[model samples]
Target: MNYLLIENDKCVGVCDYEPNVGNDNIQVITYSGNIPQERLIYVDGKVADMNNYTFINGKYVKKTKAIENLLNTNDEAKHYLNDTDWLVIRHRDQLALGQTTSLTNEQYLDLLTKRQAARERVVEYGE
Candidate 1:
């Protein structure tokens, strides 16, 4: 299975390893080359400790609850928008004219939350 090599709360790289077959120690192959088991913390991707790290797509990302929540909420909001009539010309016209759009309360809340989260990210990242 794939694993993440962590040292000092930073991801060193990714590697493959099997635990407890014949040896307690396993060599982790990284971009820099093979790293000894004693020099890194190996986190198995199968049972991830989400409090520390998260495996996203094909890479390991550090787990930050606030960022995760923001991303999840944004994805949900985008999905809802895509699945609804929000993309229709009539809806755009209504929004442009300051008329009541077809947005549901939940959708509006999700958008609001996403906006707040984005602002927070901008402030945090100073970009």
Candidate 2:
């Protein structure tokens, strides 16, 4: 079982072993599942992702993503780059074969522009 190390109302971290420390501000909760890095652990052992929700008045409330938190945004950019890389490769291979590629020059340029923008965003908000 995984244990959530909750300090105050926030889930500070997770541990596999049971915590035996004596502190009024610290609490632990156990569950049988994969706990994400940023998650909220309720007193009843319910867990919620911090990215999509916020704890308020002892309940989890839905909220919009904060712009300052760019880790997820950077990851999304990287994913976009990786997922569309095959299109570029295919375009190159078709050109080498002296055949008409499925992707037009305009389409290829658009993809390149979008990929460049994604890369720039990742750099601007680096991990």
The sequence of per-residue lDDT tens digits that candidate 2 reaches over residues 19-74 is 77585677778868877766555534567667766444465555655643565777
What TM-score, over all chains together, does every model reach? 0.29, 0.46
Model 2: lDDT to the true structure: 0.75
Check candidate 1 and list the clashing pairs. none
Looking at model 1, report the run of 10 residues with the lowest lDDT sum: 118-127
- Candidate 2: lDDT of 72? 71
Give lDDT tens digits, candidate 1, residues 24-88.
Answer: 23343234444444424345523234355554555556668875786676566556555543445
Compute the lDDT of residue 85 as modeled in candidate 2.
93
The CA lDDT of each predicted structure is 0.52, 0.75
Q: Which residue runs does candidate 1 get wrong by more than 4 Å?
A: 1-52, 56-58, 85-127
